[model samples]
Target: MARSISDTGSVVRAVRVWPVAGQPAGLPDSLPEPIAAVAVPPAGPSWPEHRTRFAVEVVGDGASGWHAPVSEAVARLVVDTLADGVVGHDAAAPRKLAYRPRASRHHQGAHARQAVSAVELACWDLASRVSGRTVPELLGGTVRAHVPVYASALGLDPAHPEAVKVAAWISEQGFWGQKWPLTKELLRQGPVAVARVLGNLREAAGEGRFMVDGLRRCRLDEALGLLPVLADLRVAFAEELLEPGGVAWARVRAAGAGVPMAAGEHAVDEHEQTRLLTGGAVDVWQTDPGWSGGLARSLHTVEVAADLGMPTFPHGDRLWAALALAGACCRDKVPAVEWHLTLEPLRQRVFTDPGAVEAGMLPSGPGIGLAPTPVITSPLPVWTVGS
Candidate 1:
């Protein structure tokens, strides 16, 4: 008889949260500094210059698992409140151990969700290590050997004169596709200019090889105007073209424009996801496990979306979880995952090789495969709570 997860007797023993200092890493000189679609004043010192990210680790009887880079506040929340529920529970049953508000009275907001997500991921890692299985294996054995990924050019300005060259280079790098933000600045250049830039990029990257992100920076009218141009360029999809929850209107307009729409990275809970699905707002769903709850909830969302004939390309904010889902789920359901070009390297600084992408695919590894290295020189956890 096979041993079950409950048979392992690996209950959670400790949870630690800490800040990790960012370090400078080499990036391609040809690539320009990435910029935000909506420029806002800096809240504090920038990355690699200060301690900007946090990490979480869960310890079981004889195994440990870790995840990184959430906000310090989230880390503190876990240490102060959430860790208590996690400490004596079955580490292998992450869904049951994950934090949830006591009742409807307690507000369930982004911070709570993030806190839950971090703790839950650490639990999954701990569970995987205790069971001597990878997260995908624990979820259910992988359906594919590797998960395909797309290069997300979050900071690369699409309006640059060399944008065409950059697109060609990305395609040559073996990414399944590339996604660039359709910024307000680019849209201000007028429809003709937008068409020219997208046309050049499409020609450079080849047909069906690129996507665009509106980043919810566009007015509904502005997004509507771009639909025809996107369709004409044969762009793969237009992601978050308008503000979230404008579902019904977006669905009608998108259907009329003959362009596929995508959204849901900000839909962090079931209410939001249900609205998108019931409204038939998008052709593609892009849930982020880190924000939507954890691997378990996000995977459930993927299944529901697939049943409705919607495919998911999970947002890359939490690369490991997204990769795990993509690897384990049906290929037709989870076609690929986003790989943010500017953010991933910085995020992976604390890990050995957990989220490395090669030739547009993520290679399989044990557990969540994220363990902090000496590179994380933080002397001690900012906070810790144990059973």
Candidate 2:
């Protein structure tokens, strides 16, 4: 019965992984330094942007999976990896497959982790579909059915004076928290200008939980100088105030900023998550399963944070997975899921039956255990066309 149930768990019967082609032929021979070199190319109605598809389906048995999750085209690399890997594995035992052994033993880098996240998400979706329960119920049960959200904006137009437009839109959606990235260029404009930006953001968001994500920039002294103004503005929490590292982290922690600090997205492994937690460097432990290995690793990170009595606010992406785990395990400390306000919603929309992200919580259901939405748009092309 267990085997039968596991076998028929996922709605998807089988899947295939295919690499879709980008417009411009081969990517740069050598990746540019400061690897943010891979900027996004524009796509419009005429040119449909394509992502590598792991043509996933639930099959009778003997299925397979592979990698090369990176793409010069799209950033949602995890979707394909998980779709490919989790296709045949008992969606019931997804956590085991997530930590499955590899021959060469690649490190838990972004690609590998993204793969795990995709599979875990799919498994949860399958479980929810099979069981007819929301993912939150599968995990445990929600403390609150709808989670309050904070609008995240590391991708918003910096020069656009109407930057507040997005925040206001989020406010309109009933989100109370709103965050914007702090660029070095903006910071160099000095505290006055920074204050002006903050004032603008607050005016746009009203009495919401406004936040600043520094994106791991700034030195200790620089952060120290900025802390007072941030605290005075009654900012909720200063995220990634200093570049993550032992010395710099220690310096920022020692600065005694009246305001709380949030960090830990850079933690690439379970051990690093533990070190950061033990070091007392971060007030909010933000784990990204797409970077911190996979669901198991992320769960371990959350466990560590929970042990220390801190909240685990995942650093965006794979939010459904994070919220599912949060519901199952650490409820109290899971303050809010970092809703990447601009990007993730589009991915959800592409799904035929995307998971219900109402209020904030990803609804719990059955099978792999979250809402069943066909997140994949289409299968990636196997052969290059018109070349």
Candidate 3:
């Protein structure tokens, strides 16, 4: 007789969150100042100097699953409220395990939501390991063997003399495209300056292969003014141009802006994502699994986007999850994933495999492939909860 799904599934036995000290290998001693810092003050400590990092692990009867590079606060939030519900539950059913915490608190906020998402991701990783399958395969067999990725130039300053050189290097590296931030400071420099910088970047990155992130710092008029320049440059897309929850304004902008509009990285739940999709807010969806309630919710958003004739280009924070979704979905629906050029090298240092890109594509690896490296030397977990 063949075993059923339940027979093979593992129950969650314990959950642990560890705080690792010191920076991982491959991170530069100093990083370029972020473009957003010019317009908006940073909310927390700088990444280079921030010595502590968190990783979550879910231990089960069959195997252990892991997800790293979350905040200490988010890891603590998991142990405090969400871990009790997760303990002793079926690890294979991550969505079901996530429901109690999501439904119980009306105001779990982004940190709490991220905690739930981390646990949910761990559960899926555990389930995939127990079943001897990759997370993408477990989700539904992969549609593509490799996922294309674009270089997201987060820390690279467009005003720097080497900006064009960096853009050309990224192009030479075979990235699908390069995205540069459009901070309000840059916008205030007037459209002439904006056009010149973007024009030079486009020429360096290759025509039709450059994208812009407005960083949600621009006013309606500023964003509208940018549309013509973006369209004339034949930019790939403009992301988060207006303030959050300005879907109506985004829709209006999309109607007239020849460049495609993208958002939803800040949408915390399915309801918010649904509103964005239904309101015709954007031509492209850019949900992040790590921050947007995990892979299950992100996948659902991808499906909804597909049904509505929109494409999803998942945010790059959690590269493994983004790669999993891109691998599982039709190429047309999820054509590419974002690669944070500056941050990913540091992020990848925690993983054993690093999931390196070749020819601008990441090969589908096994089980979300987030096994932590020896660099995570913390002997004691900050928090642990078990059945």
- Best prediction by lDDT: 3
Model 3: per-residue Cα lDDT over 76-149, one tens digit each = 77777777777777877765675554324544568766877788777778887887778888778878878888
The lDDT of model 2 is: 0.56
Q: Which of the two candidates, 1 or 2, achieves a greater lDDT against the reference?
A: 1
Ranking of models by TM-score: 3, 1, 2
> Can you write out model 1's per-residue Cα lDDT over 235-287, one digit (the tens) per residue?
77888777766653555454566777788888876788888876777788889
* TM-score: the better of candidates 1 and 3: 3
- Which 10-residue window of candidate 1 scores lowest in summed lDDT? 34-43
TM-score of each: 0.88, 0.73, 0.89
Ten consecutive residues with minimal summed lDDT in candidate 2?
A: 31-40
Lowest lDDT sum, 10 consecutive residues, model 3, at 35-44
RMSD of each: 3.9, 8.0, 3.9
Per-candidate Cα lDDT values, in order, are 0.72, 0.56, 0.75
Model 2 regions lying over 4 Å from their true place: 1-15, 18-89, 131-133, 141-144, 157-172, 329-331, 354-372, 375-387
Ranking by lDDT: 3, 1, 2
